[model samples]
Target: MANDTNEFWGKQAEPFRAFFDMQGEAMREMFGQMTPQGLSGAIPSATMAPGDMAEWAKVAGELQRMWLEFVQERAQKDMAGANPMDPAQWMLMTQSLAKQVPMAPLESAQKMAGDAMQMWQSVFTRFMAGGDPEDKPDLPRKDRRFADPAWQDHPAFALLHQTYLMLAEYFTKAARDVEGIAPDKRKQLEFATTMLVEAMSPDNFLLTNPVVMKRTIETKGQNLVRGMQHLINDLRRGQLTHTDSDAFTLGENLAATPGKVVHETPLYQLVQYSPSTEEVYETPLVIFPPWINRFYILDLTPKKSFIKWAVDQGITVFVVSWKSADASMKDVVWDDYIRSQIEAIDHVRDRLNVPSVHTIGYCVAGTTLAATLAVLARRDEADKVKSATFFTAQVDFEKSGELKTFIDDGQLEMIGKLSSEGYLDGRYLAATFNALRGKDLIWNYVVNNYLLGEDYPAFDLLHWNGDVTNLPAKWHRDYLRDLYRDNKLVVPDALSADGTPIDLTRIETPAYIQAGKEDHIAPAASVWRATRHFKGPVTFLLAGSGHIAGVVNPPAANKYQYWTGDSSAASLKEYVEGADEHPGSWWPHWLDWLESHGAKKVPAKGKRKPGGKGDKVIEDAPGRYVKTR
Candidate 1:
């Protein structure tokens, strides 16, 4: 009976051994087909290229190493009975391996043929483009090491490249298997690891191929040109940054100085139209800024600062410099921010004796200002504010784009975990933003400075981007959950800071909404939606450039083109109609609008000194907190 059972088992093993042999044969055949001519579907009777021979040797060496490792790992697994492939797993693995088995040959052939073509193309282009022989044109800009001229004639380069190509093919095949495996059971990782090890074989780096070298040469050449262009562009921006300082600093200096006379209104005081002024309108202006960033982006260094321009034009400038949330104020929320704006307006009213205030809200601060207006409207205190300005602020979230990707459930959970500590550290906030646009700020610097051997200059915007601010945990949670993720701001019956559901329609103030044509964060369409909710007249201005550049517009740097004229009341539709408009800054247009309605008088030298309002100077203007991290 025992002899009969052994015979039965041996017979079963015969078929399994035969199947394994066939699979191995298929793999060998695939590897053999990696010759350039074989891959190109043509047979070459001529001798093998010396470079191709070198690549084959390198591949053989790496394959031998991988085989040893695989055998050792398999032996360990067999001993431990830890084979992930039990009967069911074995069947699945067999099927998966069967599909991937041909991949190595396919990849080998592809690389061999591709390299041959690349070599021929490089030799042809080098002569045709007609550059100095010494200054060979670079091809692929990314990999500079591949640009060695010796690669064209070196036999080892061709061989190693071809080998690596085959390794890459196998690696890709294995990576696909890994991706297919259940996340819990990463059986494919072992295969992927083997593929990566083989692809990065030391022999692969021994000699660079002509194809790779030519690509490098071309890429390096293009990078050289691009670097020059970037330098020129940076220099121009530097000049603009300098010139912008002159424009904004002049205005800020005047405001900061004791008695440097400018317009009829005192530099720092809100200019309310009295019977004494040329023109009088009921609308008063109050400016709101988030404590997260420096207020100067709205009022950057002189000709650039919109605040200075607005003040000079006799617009009532009640700017709110939000006190940064300190350790003691960890529990501050959306309600607190809104209340601060309300208090600011009341302070301006009590101090300047203005009956109604026009509110200008900047970025996130715009949300609070809008909320304040809604609160006022809810209580029938709309009389307090006559007009409102929203600069790159959103109440609607339908088209929030990448920002939406950021506030998903996982992010909320992470934020919740982080906020368990006191404050949401500001540096983390800055880092998040930096990563969002890392290609330009971080990677670009690495490529230019490290790879291209160039120096990166000090960029003020980059500097500012690095400066981060923390949000109070409660404030961030509420802001994200209530307003951003939930679309509470636009909903008429949504729960708000007050017990009653907030209604934006109650906001009857005239609105001046300005957005950038290329603004990514708050698309003009989102900003335009506010007009639909507000029961008031709306003037939407689409300026050129991105969020920051659009808002901190300088008249001197008329780099941006704007859309204007009697257009439709709709935001996006008007923008579409106003495309291809002439070049000019949005500042002048806003200035014209304000000047037409602002209080008018001769430049005044009224000796009212801004002595910090007799309050102790606890922190500097723009503040230390905003500049840190």
Candidate 2:
């Protein structure tokens, strides 16, 4: 090689290069010492190894032949191009081939080693820190975290745990691999290598890297500091403007103007309905939103929120705004939720003077709706619910996606153990759900806001995620035992909300079920299985994204792809009828159906304009509850 100054490598690379050269010298010295000491024949039976050596030689020859062939093929490609022998061009070819090699396995191996060392250390640390798993406190009473059916059988979590175990094993094996290495050379080669490997490990680097962890602490401190700054900003702005009935009107447009609130209804003003307004539609719409999130996601912003779309399409909507559970709501159960929904429906009935209503149940709310539907059907009150729409809802448990991994006999029993307390805590459920998406959701937060000192806005979506609600223990236990463990929702004679056999066939209302193609909670196939149980006209729509994104999806963006089967043309089986085509977002198709069912404009009953006598309005569009946690 021509003598050249090390211009390509910076001063930082020198220490690494020097260390590498030292390792080679150490290896040579180690071999020299062993050769004369007669310890070099340490490998199993050198004399008997001749036959094995011959086989190895044969394998080496074949590998060389294959490698030569590969080089020749590449050489031909290079020769075909102009300026074939240019050294720089050849370097590019070499680099391209080098890039194709899979380095993740090597990276993973190092990670395994580091994780093993940490786990070994943790045994001692846990003892000192009093963090032993056995010392963990018993499940709390009134903890809603235990009640979520997803807890019993979450698949993503199971995968993460399995990955963790494999990493541990890999680490232990690496330590063994280096054990046979000589001690004198160990410092030169193995020690530094171990340190470097440990430094880059997922556990060490991600879980507890001093540099990264310090940055995280700094970022969190900065966030609090910034929060204080925002409070100051608010105070300064408050001086310029005035507070109008607990609502602060911004003097400066510091936040993005018209920052859209998605997947919820506007509740800026207290909702008011006059009983004197005569009904135009034959049936009204009563939407049930999950207590886990704010009710308004369905009516988020003007054009995008499902509630807005439905209202614009001329459907009379009444959404229940759930109050955060306190000691007063401690005794609530599945029956209570059912009663609340019924009471809301009654309110709509009294307001519009309508006979029956169309009930749309979303996420976990759908399960509650199914129970109510069954109760209504048994009492021959089917006239109460004109039709039902389930958005990303699961009635069948067999193929319920990753959420199932958290459920099993053991987990359910554990939940039952926890429920002796009054309510299921929502904060715990939020933490676990956040854990499920640790790499993307949790780690992303750590790196972005914590490590990078970035500021995320007080967006409505984030706010809703922050605002969590508790679940009653009795309700949650039955939910898990019936829905997840036993797959009771679809079975006619399966255990019911009240222990009476739930027969979904009796819930014969026209049903429209929608699920996302990428939904991790409830798969499309699981939603499609509703056809087998419900005798009603079942319409299955497969949307494009995940649970939340798919439902909040709008037409103006026009990003998603979805499919829907004929509601009455035939059963879900016969409707496909060899059709192998894909359709776009279910939003427009749903809008069309809603328009067909929607009543044309009846005269504005009360007044042409607001008398300001009705419940106060928040803003023209997006509401207050969504903006404020």
Candidate 3:
């Protein structure tokens, strides 16, 4: 707090060599804490020589001098609560440097004149001696954008792709090298630049991309004509099509696990799944999935359905199907969502005649569940929830990854404007998330459906991803302001749900927190930090893949693995070192931890079922609410 300026610029800036050492350590920490080593694949493949570092430092200093005004202007906006800087500007500035100047030099003074000339000569001599520009140079790891065989085999295509990468590298390096700015702001600038660079890739266009062009040539332009049709269809729907929508029937194939919607509310519908075993756990399991989207991610299919799996394991499972907010739900605040959870908890207790139930909260729902637990504890009803499990839920926002880019002053204001009609449209939230992974979620579809004119196959995950939902403006506003931006959720009683002060430390329920090793939305670092907030015995698990793939992982697939670590490790590094890697889904491990929480089994023959209670059955599993949008 004391040093607004890590100020690695100006006269007081740390010595250039020392500053880079500090930067290196910070970069290591960021990636080391957020993901496993193999996942940090975006780093430049080529390493810098000692002399190159000095030249790079000089270039950086020159860049800082040029961009200092822009940073200052942004700082002013930040202080005034203005939108500050737009990402497009970041892209334009970097693009200009790469185009306007060949990144020539800082040759005004005699400083590095000999070195600069030698550098230029070396570059020219090296290229002239090289056999072919078509021969691929060392490039960034994990960049599958140029994976097509033609990109590697065809001379012209290879040259074109390599040139694009050079320009991209130049622009990104320039944008990321800006100094005289705070670290958080630097990250936003760097990320925005990278996004634009990724967007402008040669592969995204029909003409420049070899594969798309090849297909168009072979199809005699019919590919482009079909692509136009897809464009028209997407325009009508107001978004890109990620899957063959017709292939998935919600209640039939997608959310197909048999169950009954026993309880319904304006905000959510509680679906109590029929048990698959003769005996079930006395304590039921309740899932509060993210309202920002549908709950069916956990109940996708018989093979991948977590709900069905639990049911088969002699555990009765109930999941909340949240209502997509409309104009009528405009006045709903954060507490209303909290009350809905409390209501669902009580309803489950009353219907099943159980003292407590195990609960699982995925993504945003998990954050609110923590607050719900605090509310329950403060209200002297903490016994209602037997145990808690969080799937990629971030309570501490300090290391909340790229999602924060959308929380800037201007973006938040834009959200406010969009939500004037009570809540922000589902499309807006969906678009924001799509932009985060624009290369895949946005542009990949753009090239496939609009350029290559390919029809997307039926994919359950993409189908689920496309079914976006509304975000309550008031609740969402408070969420962005108080939680994401303000960092108040970690403080004791700093937040409240309808006047009941919520505190995380007050809740004593045992917790099993699962985080994706590669989760970007709810970063591993951010998720791991929450373990310290709970006073109970918290068991933290790290799963392979990302937020969606990791949580939806099915053991039978025998795919990616997971890791178990000590919750109280001193740091993320220590925590990871202490981790014991396991070769399967974390679902079985979670079930074991849940059962050990003292939930007794009772005969399913005479179980006090949800439908027979006063609440009664509303409809079938994955009820009418999920199908609303």
Candidate 4:
């Protein structure tokens, strides 16, 4: 037992120790070349003779030479112990590396430059002839691409757009060829370079953007003054204003669903929504929304509220509204999350007099719920959960899209340092997420709030996005390291909450897994992989649009689309190939599936009354925790 404990801790601490050791080695090497006298001479002395200036300059030169030599030595060290290569072999290796670039095989910079010049000449000639010069280029349609029509029509804007695309492609290609760096580090470099280029995009700048310039002219420079005011306000507050906060009030407009918090804990508040239908499902449904954002996302507005839709579908719903973590909750870990969820589930089960409850987890919450269920299953308590539903959530992290780039050892170490105060600041996590969709999330706001001087639309979705929540340091660290970095959840005995091994296959409860077709955070493929780990019947649904839009889609809007398939297929590819496309939202389909399952109809209890022991009303619906910054 002692050896096993020592081994576990040693494995956990190995990476950190190696990181510090490398840093220490570098520092020692750096200082070793500097003599005491030379080091002291480099600094400007309080009293010095005129001759000391030349001496100082000479010392500086020597220091510079030493730095260059050190860098060269480090570079050589990275390639040490490798097989020697002839000129031909070296050329072949270089060629092999270049092939990794997506565009390298297609065209060279010189060729692309020539193409750009020809296109520019044609555009200029057309403009001179008083014709529409902005013909849309045959570029691949991408959500991240600039969508302004003027970018194609105006020669100047067109040129700028072309330049941006070319540079982005070049940088991505170069990033792919960055040798001697770790794979994750290379990905981080690629992501950083892409973000930098996106930040410098012409569409984000007042002077370069045609729309902003036209708006400025129309507003008679008043827009600029307003923009300055916005900037000053944001600077003073140390936050980037994302939405017009005055647009929506919490209970009045946003989380207007009729409900009451029946139970409260230090971790979360459980709100039971009043049933709208005369008869409701005998088996109650409880939702666990990701704590990264407020739970109100599920109850955004009546028109788009999932809670309302579920209640109207005759399903009694309970949502977990999590409290934002602070220093006081620093000791909280995954075990705490699991314990709170189990407690909430037990309370709901006892109150409703139901043997089991249906569970729904969204995003990160889905991951947590899966872990919780696994822990329960290990203890022969799996029957507490009647069924499981996941919304755009992934258990497997192998192909977890762009978010994986930020989970490397270096970034995780830095996050560890930042969260040493017991909590990972919510702002940092929010900013990182925003950076993933920089053009739409970050620069769009910059152009609107700082350039056009426009208050963003009071969109409920954006409002929910802006309502960020902090995470306990221990809990978040466990999440990133176990799930994202090491993928421990999928590996047997690799994960646990209360010292009991978790195995996803033990979760035999029927599952309904939903994935967004264009979800950049949790890729559809990654989410689909979760279906394989569960032993019971699984229904995989693919929704149109990205993460937020895909999950928030309501049937009343008659917008977007979804695909349904035989979840028992051998692989995700097989399922997707055989899936039948369905029109409109997947909510109705999901309800139908739930009805077909074990969700029997029972008389609606109308407004919920507190019943469980110690279950007293904390406050009205959309509890105080939702209002936390």
Candidate 5:
């Protein structure tokens, strides 16, 4: 192994020895001026000031300048066969650098500097001395951004790519090495820096990205012209274009689940879907999706729609399509939504003439549903809902994930100010969620649509994602304050809904809590905490993907895996270790669980009118409320 390592470095070191010597000399030169008294002098032993984001920009700019100068200046003179830079070639190094942690001890700084020097040597050697490129890419399997042939083959682009990745990684570590700050704040710093670094990746820019450059050359800059037009159109449309919006219509293609609006309120439209099976479960299923986005996500396409699948599997489905809240709705609170939920359940029960309905909530709606159930329990109406299922929902915010970054006092104050119109703008939530996975949701599109000028595809999911919705200001504030920030929802009676004190522990409703292993919005750990509150039979399942795709995974696709039978464990980690792994979607597992929990099959209703005569059809499914925006 040592011989192999030596052999590899020996080959690389031979051609760029002088280049390495000069670059190492350059680092030492900078280190003399930038050194901490010994390292903390230049780098503080404490965390950087929370407000001093400008400092990150400065440090990043300095590194960018030094690297560009070092490579452009001495490489041609020092390294054999090293390509000499032209004015056009120098333009390739274009992106501005971002911030990093401002502190480190002298020894650690020096050691990092040495490590960086070695990485610099290796990349330079590979770019300049290493002539022939390999047939396959050296990039991580997941990051396809640099898979283009020119990125690996061209010396200048290769230099930029390798250097950017190395620096991004180094700074990622440095961002986490902060001292004297709360773990949360440090994590915020690290997340901010990571996002900044990713945002400024070479591939994100047209000049630095080989694929975009190739497209430009091929199209004679027509791609840029078209992309600019797309930018202007999107800007005019008041949102980023994530999909070909014209490709799918609400009732025509997307959200095409057959159903009719049986009930309507100021808050929501209750769409009771037409049953697909001859005999369906006697107890109907009522879904309350998060108003943070539209409810169509549960019915994206027949291939992926969980609602459609459930209906086909002999379950009558009723979904609540929440109105896009505006000034009038801004005065509403969490209690109001709970009341509305109760009203919807009553209507479904009266129309179906059933005792109770199987209730389900996704994301924030699930969080609130837990509160509603508790309220029902407190009121001695526990039998109102036969079963409760939460999809990637966090009832207890104690173990909340990245979304908490937006809930601090300072940020909440800003949000309140922005919500002067009585409701928080949907765009704010859109931006917030986008930030959680900005590399994919935001930057990737920036590179593809704006830089590479690729036309956005017709994707049902992205369309739903882009279809943002507003939250009432007071309700939003109360939620952030009570549930997320204070974490009162899971603490017995710390919170209330519609004047009823919520005590989750008092609720004995059978629960099926499904969490995604990769869920960022509602992490598995946070979701798992709900199991402790359910006095009834609790079945916790962990799905394979993130919040959306994980839950939306269909059986026919046979994509991803799921885990079951580890609810006995105390934590998500322990549960995962002991859980039974199932191949494919968790849908089937959930189906069995629902039936076992008493989703009895009987003659299907709605041969003439959907939900029978009692439930009058107001309009078709994917009704007016969903089409409002």
Candidate 6:
């Protein structure tokens, strides 16, 4: 028994010892190469001599051969024990083998070659017939893919465009047909392939991109140098530095809404905007913005501010600005969030002398709000909430858009390992979100900031998107497990905070729910499912634009229209069929509904200064919590 124990422990220790020994050797080699004399000596002096292109080429070839050998050896070792024929091990073995095989890419290349032949033949025929080759394209073009006219007019560019499209299609089909692979893994593979294809687009390369080439020549390659500098800085920082952070000041330019920090906890700060109207509603409206991003999305600018709009409309608005979690707040769970939000609400109630306050929540905050309401209902404290409003929020995440592809048993377990360390870094969230719309978010930036070498314009929405906040490990894990992975939000008593099991059906608070028609985060159909869970009178609205634009839309803009209907329909399909289309922003309709439900116009009381029992005013609106990161 002693020998067996020793053998087991020795086996474990041996790996660590070997690893450290290898690491030490690697460190020594790295340091030796880093020395100025050693670095200079490593490069062949003959290759460095003027006009010695042949020597340089030989060196490059040798380096390439060495790299290939190393990769081949590593791959062989990795695949040594895998058996592709075994039924039980087939999926794993195939996945490993797939990494070594470029079958799909080869097929795509073949197809592109054939297509190129046909295009050249067509061009030759047009030229021989005394017809202009630039008159029209032989192949039909996709509006969204390669819309640039230069791509069609130039033979080289046309060939490149067609090749890319064909290759992208082939890769996509191959990704989907990755046989017997787990759904999450398959999705990840597909996403990765999509990103690669997008990155390889001719428009991203300075040589292939006429627009960028023109700009480079016009600017004397200064733009290219600047872009290289930006890339180096970002790599050094280990984060994609989006936006010129120096462009916008927090309080002055971005979240500049006039308000006071009436109360605060370690988790959040409650901002009560000073009323601009002579009279305010009897019931105060408290909003809980999603903690995934800063709260300033609601108060972006004076003209586009939702908080200011609400305040101006005779509503006393209070917003919960969540604190950015760090390592110290890793233990903060769902219960902590619920408790803190309730405490904030209690403070608002006491300060405003209002019995029941109207509650509003957006996205993740809305989900949390619903959970908190259910918990409160279980405790017989549901009367504190007069009415509830959800913006682009979903309690039922069955079909929660493309983002759902990242949620699975394997992925969640991996995420759990990372979460165990501390807070889930915000960069991961940003990257995932960016991946969802690669063309618009990721590839667009790659072209503009990295390729075109232009500074991103100081757009408030983009700034808000870039300013990410960390999520507590425990809280985020629970959220994913309950709401996302297991679909617990719709399951009665399946989700709970503290000791109480939350049942959404038990909460009879009249609710107003809005979902964006084009919301990729939370699909309107998924959000509409929440209507069935609520026992109270529910009003559902489907807005025209995407997640952020739908909610932040003001009436004056009249940009996107909306559809409104009572939640009497049996399904989302039925509701949409019967819903009435409104020509402008849904804010006026919401205000009217709110006023009818419980909000009453009254003579405005004296402005309440920022302070509360135990927790006094720490700072003005857009408080310290919002500025943590």
What is the RMSD of candidate 2? 24.6
Over 4 Å off in model 2, which ranges? Answer: 1-282, 409-421, 496-501, 566-584, 597-601, 607-629
User: How many pairs of residues collide in each model?
Assistant: 25, 33, 1, 2, 8, 0
Candidate 1 structure quality by residue, lDDT tens digits, 1-629: 12422232233233234423443443343234433333222212244476654544443444344445544765775633312212232233223323222111123445545755675565556545655756755432223333444543344553344344444444444434433334322323333233223323322221122442243244432333333334333333321111122232322342231111112111022222112233333344667766566554555544555665665554534455444444556778777777667766776566545576667888788877788888888877878876677888887776664455345454566566656654676554554454345444434443443224244454445444434456777888777787777888888867576554577888877777887778877777777677677787777778888788887767777676877643345457765665557687777776566555444433221211222245222332433333333
RMSD of 1: 16.2
- Model 5, 1-629: lDDT tens per residue? 12422342333233334534544443343233322232223333256564433444344344444445544654564532211112121121111111122343222545556766776566566655544566333432224667777876776776666666665665666556656656666666566656656666767665466787688656644565566556545544446679988898998888998989989999999998888778888888999999788999999978888888998898989999999988889689988889989999999898878899999999999988888888899899989999999999988888898877666665677677768889887876776677678788777887788666788899999889888887899999988988898988877777777788888888799999999999988988899999887777788999999999899999999899999866868887888888888889999888888898785678875531384666557899989999876
RMSD of each: 16.2, 24.6, 13.8, 14.5, 14.1, 10.9
Candidate 2 TM-score, C-alpha based: 0.56
Candidate 3 residues 269-362, lDDT tens each? 9898877787888889899999999999987867998888888889888899999998898889889989999999999898778888899999
Per-model CA lDDT versus the true structure = 0.51, 0.50, 0.73, 0.74, 0.74, 0.72
Locate the minimum summed-lDDT window of 10 residues in model 3: 1-10
Candidate 4: TM-score? 0.79
List model 2 lDDT by residue over 1-629, tens digit each. Answer: 10111221212123234433443443343223322122222223355467654543443344344445544765775543322122343233223222212111123434545754555444334334446545733221222212332221233322222333443334333332433334322222222223232322232222222343344344423432333333233222221111121222221221112222212222112232222234334465777887666665665444456665554444555565555444445566676777666666665565556677788888888877877788777778777777788887777877776555445554455455444556655554554465345444444444344333345654544444545655666667677777876887776765555444568888888777887778877676677677677777776776778888888887766777776556444444554563343544567777555546554546434321122346233342233442333
User: Of models 5 and 6, which has the larger TM-score?
Assistant: 5
- Which residue ranges in model 1 land beyond 4 Å of their true spot? 1-284, 448-456, 565-571, 578-580, 595-609, 612-629
lDDT of 4 by residue, 1-91 (tens): 1242224223323322443344344334323434435444424466656566455445445555545565576477653221111123223
Mark the regions of model 5 whose C-alpha exceeds 4 Å error after superposition: 1-107, 127-132, 135-143, 606-615
For 483-520, candidate 6 gives per-residue lDDT tens digits of 88788888899877889998999979899999999999
Where is the poorest 10-residue window by lDDT in model 6? Answer: 97-106
What is candidate 6's TM-score against the reference? 0.80
Stretches of candidate 6 off by over 4 Å are 1-134, 143-145, 177-189, 607-616
TM-score of candidate 3 relative to the true fold? 0.79
